[model samples]
Structure formats: structure tokens, C-alpha cells
Target: MRNKKTPKIFLASFFLFSFLPLMVFADSQAESRKFFIDSSYDVANREQILATNKKVSSKAYFYVENDWFNKLEDEDKITVEQTLNSLAQEFDEVIYPRLTEAFGPEWRPGIDNDYRITVLFHQMKEGYQGYFNNGNEYLKIQNPISNEREMVYLNTDALFSKNINSYLAHEFVHLITFNQKERLRGVIEEVWLNEARADYAPTLLGYDDEFQDSNLQQRAKTFLSHQNDSLTEWLGEEKDYGVVNIFTHYLVDHYGLRILADSLKSSKVGIPSINESLKKAGFSEDFSQIFDNWLIAVYLEDCSLNEKYCYKSPNLKKLKISPSLIFLPSTLKTQFSLNYSTTFWAGNWYRIVGQEGKLEVKFEGVPDVQFKVIYVLCQNHQECSVDLMPLDNSQKGNLSLDDFGKEWTSLTLIPSLQGKVSGFDGRENYFPFSITASITRENQEQEIIAQLRAEIAQLKA
Candidate 1:
């Protein structure tokens, strides 16, 4: 879910002419009140309409579109009631405390002074779960388009599903972020990090403790399909959610939740905020180091080799990235070359396999772009060892190994862009690189000659 901002000049003009009337009518305790909703999702040709208050709790006021609520079946009404009750209780007992403690508090005693956040349910454009609009925090004189309250707008369809609570938890974090980062700090957080935090909300609330059909499980599947998705890019697609959700999970799993909390409380935003938190926590690793380790951890979730290379969560113990390209060398086809492109912080894995030969790999990347090339060698019945490939100033490196397919079962090359740490835009962000791997039978020939000499000696005997 994304929040939208309106231009300041238009808002100023609307407020000057209508401020007095809006303030006089704002205090009316009517059964229904006019609210402005995003028209992008609404099928109706209207953006302003009256929504009736259906239920009120200590912490929230649940409102539904007047027409939609009136037409609901009796059984559907009961389900909505049950869902709202569960949501209110969870928000009060769990979400409110945990997120507020981690991020910060949302605007208090909000606009109406009732201390209750508003939850509005209306028909939204399909595929949208929910969103939090910061415009609601302003008065009519400041933002004439404001809902003038702390509120989250959810799709009516969510009420009939099991994911209602999780959706609410996600948007609630946005509200907290508005106050913590934008309102108090006067800095807008990068969309990628903002969505990352919100996507991690369900897990933070323990809603994903169950692996089956849980948010974490679904995101894991999505990430596997698009494992190369740039972690810093926010395209507002499912792949974006996939990358951020799993990355944040791995982050909190290894570093603890303090990184997220401290980052939010810092004046810096995005990667800088994370780096600041890591420094304050007395850790030598920065954002780049953590991301580098994460690239390996996702590919090889083996804690036996190094604790930093795997996840502590049992649910993610079996998680690993499948190789993007698999190379099997034969006498007929002894060499392979591949040229591919990737975005910043995105990873590509190349696996090489051959028998009784020397494997030589040459890598050439864009000279100006920073790249980290890591080689993972897995031997038969032995633990895998990870090492970084040394690249020159021209961003070129080579690796030559003997006993390919004999002592080693597989070798995986992982290359990722490490140059850009901040200011990531998805447009034209692809970085291209080439990798050439060739297998030679020089070692095989020497072994064959030794065997032939031993046979000749046996015949003479």
C-alpha cells in the first residue's frame, strides 16, 4: 500500500474559502459523515460520500460505506462484527504495543480528540489490500483534502477473509511511520525501506508463526521466483514485496529488532539509517557487509560453516537460492560464456560442473561499477568453503582450479553490484557483466599417462 500527496497550492486555495463551514460542521455527531477516499480503486464515479459508523471501540472507530453496509447479508454482517472485534483486541493488546515500541507512537488524541484511530471499509480498486494516507493528520485550514483524523482505509473484501488482521497490522505501521519519520523527523523515508518495515509487520506481530499459508511462506515462494529482484527498488509490484519481506526477515533474524528500531529513531533514512544503527550497536559490519552476507546466506543456508551465512529461524533453515545458471562442461562443449545484467544489490549465481579437469573462470564487469564476486566450493562429504575473488581496478578477475568434478562436486559464482549504496531508482539501473568458464583436460591427461606407465610395468613383471 502507498500513500499519496496532493499539491500544496491547491490545498491552500480550497482551505481559504471553505475552512469556516467545514469547521462548524466537523463537530456534528451525525450517524454518517462525509469522507474523501482515493478514487483510483472505487468503481463508482464519486470520491466523496457518507460512511456510517458501524462500531466504536476504545482505540478505533469502524466505519463502512453507507450503501455497502446497508446491502450486506445478515451472515456477512455477523462476520464483519466478529472480524472487527478480533482486530480491535489484537490492535490494543499486541500490534499497538509492539510496533509503537519498535517504531514510535502515531499521532495522539488525533484530530477529533477521541484518541481513536478511524478504520474505513469501502470498495477499493481490485488487488489493493489497504493503505494509510497521511493527509488525515492535518486540519481543514492546512489541508482541505484531509480526512482530518488518524485513519486507515481498507478494502471491504478484506473483512470476509482471514487476512484482515494482517492487513490492518501492515497499515498501522505506516501510520506510526508517518509520525515517527515524516512528522517528527521532517524526512520522508525511502519507499523501499518504508514498505519493508510495513511488510515485516505481520511477522513482528507473530501472525506468521505458522509456516503453512502464512505471509512469510508466501513471500518466500515469491522471492524464489524473482530472486534477482533489486532490493532497493520499489516498483509497487509483488516482486518488490518478495524481496523486502524476506530481506527484512533475515535482517531481524540475524541482527535483532534493535537495528530496525534504532534506524527509525535516527535522523538518517534508508541505508544510511541502517548503517548508523550498525555503528551505534558497536558492529564492524555496515549495510554493504550485511547485504553481502545476506546474498550468501540466501544461497547457502548452512550455519555449520559460519553463523552469519544462515538464518536462525527454523522456518527459513531450508531456504536457499537456486542457481540462476548451471554449467555442465564436456569435451564437446568445454567452454561457456554468459553476459547478464542486474540492478544494484541484486545477486546472480552461476554453477559450474566438470570431471577430472581444471576449471578456469574469467569475469569482466562494467569498470566503473563496484562488484563483489564470491566463489563457493562444495567438496564431496566436506563442508562448503566460501571465499571472495580478488578483482583488479578494471573490475576483472579470474579463478583457476584443479580437480574439478573430483574433489569438488560443484562451484557457484555469486556476483552482485555493491557500488550504489543509496538513491536507488529503478529506471535504467541495470548493470551488465560477463562471465566465461572453460574446462581443460590437462590434469586428466597427466593422470591417464601415470596409469598407462603403471600398466606397462605390470606387463613387464
Candidate 2:
């Protein structure tokens, strides 16, 4: 039962509150976006403008500031121009329409008759690829950049050399959010959700960063390999861009991508806005409930096992992690719960020792729990054979484990989420769950039955 197995359960460690993929900032991440107020810094001294290039017909302007721009050949400029134009088309053709549908009529790109925003194709200090600030923040009361127009300070050196599409996609989402949220709700989006959505932009465009880099698998492996790890561990850590991306993707897959628009227009700012978005998107379950399903689906993603309860992560079928061995000291009884903040599929394997005749195992999940089941399968040694199935429905409450195969010396208890984690009202995400598992033998059952029979006989006499 203690043999090494490979399985990565994502739910065990749910620390994804600081959903990421942002730098510490070239100069104050907190201050980077408040451009209208912070004019003291001399951006001009760092790099002199070599040339101002324009297509006359196009709305976007490329202001070449660093010497690196002058160094590029004319052919390179054409490539940059094509890429920028393609992005602009993406904004007009797809992004704008979809976002407008989600946030409503007033939520759109640009404000004035020109409807043009600025992208400064200049040099930024190293380490930053590109950035979008509320260049229109001065008109904050009337909505963020529509009146003044948005400007993206580009790090041409970084952009030209790296994955330009992905870089642009990420920053563009930021610009969209600023305009949409400010225009509609008159408030900025919450930083975590705002930043998380920005990272999700690349994924939305079909560039799967998490799956491509195997970051989801790698991160899930960390949670599965270490027994002590939990969602609480990485709650606010900054290296969570991957975590946030997958989480957002899961939401889109389950409820359709409209959740983005619903989240933006809600008057409720941070988490509440997410809940509101879920509600608008016809999801009875909010962030917390969906998170519960996500935890189970991250590992148990096999649609063959249960389609209604699984994610569409095709790669997950090939990626199985080694389950951590749960150590039990006394009677091999333990009380545990599913309260982590992650939505990855994972479970624990417990070796049930010193038992033979009709061993009984019990599980008790949280009230209103939807996906709690106990699996009894052991696959390690040849001498031991107790390959059993789970014992419980998808709902909450105590379930009996009386059907474990006979003549099985070793047994493995796998507590996994068997159903979609949702609320009766379909609006809660954080559900408190616990299972108090205690084992009993046939002898104990017989003794209790005999005592009841004796009492009945005495009453008859």
C-alpha cells in the first residue's frame, strides 16, 4: 500500500488568491498605472526619440524613442507594423464586440469621433515587454481613457525579440479592462481579477500557456508530491499567473466565456463581481462552488469516468500524479475536509491495515456537498488484491463502505470529489467539508446484534 504511485491532485493545495503573471514593476507596480498623477519622473531623459513613424491611414502611432529602434532595418519595421495592424483588427473584429456584449452598449473601445488610442512603440527599461496605463486617468470621473485616448508604452526591444503575439494579447486585455470597467461601473477592476484576466487573454486567443509549459501539471505535482502543501500555502504568492490562467479558462469552459462581460459590468467590485457574473451567466454556482469542481477536475479530468463532473482538459488524461500516502497512527481513523482554494483534481491514498472480515469505512462530507466519494482501490503489490470502487453518491452525509471485496488484505481509501461542487442556490464557492472516517469489523456488528436479541428475549419472558 505504501508503494510509490504517480498522481497530481490539484485540489490539495489551493493557494491561488493572488492569481498572477505580473512583474514587481520597473518602478513601483502600484504606481505604474497611475500615470496621470505621476509626471515627476523624466521618461524623456531615459531615451531620446529618434523618429516618429506614421502610416497616415492607420490610427496607431509608433514613436521610436530608443536607439535600438533606429538600428532596426526597414524590413523589420514592416513586420512590426503588420503585427500591430493584426492586433488592431483583433480588437475591432472580435474583442470589442464580445466585450461589449458582456458589459453592455456603453462599454466599448475609445470615446471620441476618432476612436483612436496610442501605442508608443518606444524603448522601456529592460525586463518589461509592454505596459498600458490610464493615460486617460485625468478624465477618471467620466470613464477611464475614452476622452483622452489610451497609450501603451511599448518595450520594442523586448517585444521585437519575444513572442510578440502573446505579449500584445496580455497588455491589450489590460487596456480593454480599464476602458470597459471605468466607463460602465465608474471604478477600476480589482487588481487580482484585473491582472488574472489580463494573463487569461493569451489563453482566450487559443494560446494555451499553462498547458504548453506544463505549468499546470508541474504546479499540481508540487501539491500532490508534498503532503503538507495546501491551497493556503500560495494564497498571495506572485508566481501564480499560471494558476489564475487555468482557473479563468475553467470558468469559460463550464459556463461559456460570457462570464468576463458579466464580471465587468457588475457594481460589486472584486469577488462579489465574480459572483454576480456567474449569476448572470446562468450559473447557479459562484466562484467558490466552481472552485470545488475545479479542484476535483484538475486530477479526475477523465470524461470517461464522469463527464458531467469533469473538465475538458484532454491533456489531463495523460498526466497522472503519484498520490501522497496519508499516515494514520492509531486505529487508522482521520477527520479531513475539502476547503482548499484550488480547483485541481487530487486525492489522498490511505493504507488500511490489520483488517479482514467485512471492514466498514464511513465518510461524512460538508452539508450540501456535491462531489464527495471514497475510493477503495489498491494497485501496488501482487500478493494484496483489494481493487474496489468508490462507496457513496455525489451528495453529502455519511456513506457506508461495506462492499469492499472479500479476501483483500490491503485496501486503499481514496477520498475524491465525485460530483460537480455547486450550491443549492448556485452562488457559493467556498464550502466547508469534512469526513470523519472510522473503521469497524464484523465482530463488533455481531456483538451489537446479539445484545439486541437478548434484550428482546427478556422482554418476551
Which one wins on TM-score?
Answer: 1
- lDDT of predicted model 2: 0.46
Residue 211 C-alpha lDDT in model 1:
82
Question: Could you give me the TM-score of model 1 versus the true structure?
Answer: 0.89
- In candidate 2, what are the lDDT values of residues 1-461, reduced to their tens digit? 00010123122222321232233211111111222211112244442244354322233433444355457699986876676566557655655455444444321234322334455555544445566655342333333322244445556663354355555556666766665665445565655566566655555555444465433444344434443222221233333443555556667767776777667666666567778878776678876666555554554454554453455555444443344343323332333332332122224445554433344444444445454344434322333222234335543444344633344434554454434421211122443344443445556667678888998999999
Query: Could you tell me how far off, in angstroms, the CA of residue 339 lies in candidate 1 after the best superposition?
Result: 1.0
Clashes of 1: 1
Candidate 1 C-alpha error for residue 313, in Å: 1.5
Please report the candidate that would top lDDT against the real structure: 1
Residue pairs clashing, model 1: 41-125
Question: Candidate 1 on 191-231: residue-level lDDT in tens?
Answer: 78888898888888888888888778888999999998889
